[model samples]
Target chain A: MFFDEFKSWQKELTHYSFEQVSQGDVERALGHERLDFMDFLALLSPAAKLYLEPMAQKAHRLTLQNFGKSILLFTPLYLANFCSNQCVYCSYNIKNKILRRKLSLAEVEVEGKAIAEKGLQHLLLLTGESRQASSPEYIADCTRILRPYFASLGIEVYPLETQEYRELYAAGIDTLTIYQEVYDEDIYASVHLAGPKRIHRYRLEAPERACEAGFSGVTIGALLGLGEWRKEAFFTGLHASYLQKTYPDVEIVVSAPRMRPHAGSYKPQYPITDAELVQILLAYRLFMPRGGITLSTRESAPMRDALLPLGITKLSAGSLTSVGGYAESTETGSAQFEVSDERSVEEVVAMLRSKGYQPVFCDWVNLRDRRGA
Target chain B: MQQVNCELLNDPFEIGGQKLRSRLFTGTGKFSSHELVPQIIEASGTQVVTMALRRLDWRNPQENILNYIPKGITLLPNTSGARTAEEAIRIARLAKAAGCGNWIKIEVIQDQRYLLPDNPETLIAAEQLVKEGFVVLPYMSPDLGTARRLESVGAAAVMPLGAPIGSNRGLQTRELIRILIEEISLPIIVDAGIGRPSEAAEALEMGAAAVLVNTAIATADQPLEMAHAFRLAVEAGRSAYLAGLGARRDQAEASSPLTGFLREE
Candidate 1:
């Protein structure tokens, strides 16, 4: 499991200072012939700031060579906003005065058809972290309903047991996306005031459980502004690398979601700059050439467009972050976060084409993962 | 045995009911720009071009990769990232469903360090694809047993790697491939790791039916020129094989009796 790898690295990096990382180490990492973890660390170091241009160049070439000039696009459909946890940085915090809503089964079919009409073949279903509000059977039913419309289905809901994940896979969910809101235990505990999301270890191992349950793909990340930026990025890389190396066949994607404005006014403790996010993304591409790098809709349109050449393979386009957001329903759930890139799916497709990128809707057929769908 | 003639050398190279004019097969990966793709295909004179299935976007027909490849080229859509037989079969079905040709290259790579093709999964995939009326060419390690099995399962051709894919190592498994050539009834198309024109020539001269050159041509500084060079080398090597290479001997067989003149024996 990644927990052992995560704990050991977390303890070891405690005494090690980023200031000690020299320019020479960063250069050696840049010039390394094959990708390795040590080289990734050097690239992520502070001294690598001067080598960002070279790192970006290498990352671009590597990404193009491994994955062609195609950017996969998938939109998130926020199923429900009801949460048992009090994640202070999120808009879905129960303490916040937000209109929490869950889509009925008929509304789900409507939303699925609405997205399907836009020619999207892949859909990511997301929900708040509350079993009482959204149970496993409820999510599975949603998966079954969405299966007929989309060629593939992914989930970003609360973590579940291996059996639950297996049941979802059988129900047409082949991919799992989970973000351990923060990696630092102390900061994690402070932010997640209540509920099962407080268990950081379980959240971290959710991707592993999904893998063990035979999911074909897993996207794992850490919300950037919650803790020390560099350490969180490193832990996220280590976590992703562990899963990648263990499940070589499974598609591993790394996403770096920055803190966007939400319902609550929670300021970031360690706000990372835009250039730092680029460095993190480039380092990820260099480390795992085959593993995917996804750019979320939390960033501005210009920011996402500018970072495309620096090793981004997956993108979220025309995303609606509220429950029943796509359908013409009177009851609209509050958004988990504000949308920064409001370009419609057509605009996103045109932008990708103008930038010489073919926007892909479905990557995997996922025939093995789906049984009776 | 009868002597090889020019007419025999000019005979059609047919595999799975398709007659290929060029013995060199090119790929669309590793190129810096898609604009260079047509040039490389033209320079290489390849009739079949391989590409990954994940690179295509069926929804956006205008930005399709098919636009980049010129007409009359057979596309060999590969299952590059598929890890199991089911995944490979699914990709094949999707390709067929999308109106892409039925020709499929089954690559089931399990290891990341070497990118070694898993022979078991490949056989499973090939068997199912062939049954489904799709022409299947499975990339595999050059083993006589596996080659024979592939032939028995109606594989169009058995593509054995010369070395690890994209390693630029060149013909590390020549002896094994030579055995496959001698034993298997199917065509022995050497794929991957022939990084230079001379290595491609060597593969053909050793009796490989055709050579698939991708990285050696795509990654070259003068990719088009390299493609032309590989085309000429593959043609020369195929001609040399038809003309028959000379047998080898440990001791030197002096031409013009140089030993008698120098040693005064």
Candidate 2:
């Protein structure tokens, strides 16, 4: 599998010290019209920090050339907060004493209607890593219920087998988002202890399975604060590159979400600063100019706004990370992470216009209804 | 002496049940503004325009791309992201459902380096989509055999690339395209790798039914003017082809009388 390939690249990345990434490497990377894996590594190094301005400009140009001046807008609708894992970082970890809630099918409809009212045609359904509450059948049911309301539906749930992904795809789900959390197996195992999520290989291969199951899009990411940011970024790039080469038609999105504040008192062992995050995103853009890079509400509104022109092609607006939060005013369950951008969907759209970008809501049409039509 | 005028350039062609007056088709991508697209289309006198399907904006679901396109213009929705026949068929159905009409551009490309369309997948999609009541125009590399297959599958037209898409390297496969134009019975519309108006003219001059240009016009400093230039070029090339361009000679064939020249005497 690609796990071995990924580990080999990871091992190769470890041999190069930070200082070895010289100014010459940065300039050479910037000068090339098409970037390679080495160019990506060079851009992620500390030496590339001095050339951020040129890198940002080139990334902006490349983004415009590939995706146009449009940002794909989606909002996450957290379906359930139930958990089976004792992850050190997340708020919904079973070890935490936070309240848990799972929405019924009726409640999901209400939430879907609420999101529809926001003028959003694309939605991401999220849940904690619990097979019992958020089983494949349950997720497929949710997809069926929400399929009528949204033109595009994505899920960020526990990794499933190839057949399970095919089942979800047939149920009107078009996208699957799975974060490896950290590429380093040791750090991943230490954080996600005693659960199905602890298996690194399963999660690492989930996106490929989704692609093989006929998903139009697959997103992979790493929580930045878990291990060395540069190493994590390299592995993320490698993984995304491999997937892109394998599934040439699939839209592969790479996101580097920084660890946010949750109910659990767990903090980032090696927190990635804002500047470092920007550098990492720029590296990704330089590496895969045609690939999609996503920015979520986990970052502050100001940071997200500033980074729009840099490389981000997708943005999540007006997100709520708690079960049943979209339907009712009551916060019945603890949020997985606090949303830093509290702006409404309208405000986000207005902001995008002010920056000369179009906020796209529905980028896909569901053709599975052809038989009914 | 009698007055003479060019009259052989009045021929019209039909694709997907739409009779097009102009031999030029335009695309809606890479434009600086959506509002400018209609103007460029009008200036170019193109009757068919192509666009892609993506998710609609949640904030303004009614702000559709169809609104910008003027009425009476045939909209050609392309299946650009589909790598397989199943995905292409799904997109074609969805595009028809979205009211983009039945004309579908089958572009099943899995190769990333050159962005070449997959011939087998495109053939599969064209057959299925044609059976499903669609006007399928399959894009393929300039391969005569694939062009024949697409035609046998009831493709309305065959769009063979002059070169790699967006490369602006004009007509690298001119000989192969010439072979397609000779062998294929359907309208051979030269698509992609046309960077300038002259290249578009060259394609038409070689007996192409039409030429579809996007990046050449859209990325120009003045898209409107570029569209105008392409319009004139297409017209000129069609006229030249109709007038019967003189055959090439290995040796010099002087227009003037060589034996009666005073200097030669």
Model 1 lDDT at residue A171: 92
RMSD of 2: 22.1
Give per-residue lDDT, candidate 1, residue B5. Answer: 74
In model 1, the runs with Cα more than 4 Å from the true position are A368-373, B1-265
lDDT of 2 by residue, B5-82 (tens): 636655788887677879999999998888998899899999999999887788877656788999999999999989
lDDT of 2: 0.87
TM-score (chain A only) of candidate 2: 0.97
What is the lDDT of every predicted structure here?
0.86, 0.87
Summing lDDT over every window of 10 consecutive residues in candidate 1 chain A, give the lowest-scoring window: A364-373
Per-residue alpha-carbon lDDT of candidate 2 for residues A185-301, written as tens digits (9 for 90 to 100)? 899988887777888999999999999999999999999999889889988998998888667679999998999998877889999877788889989998998899999999989
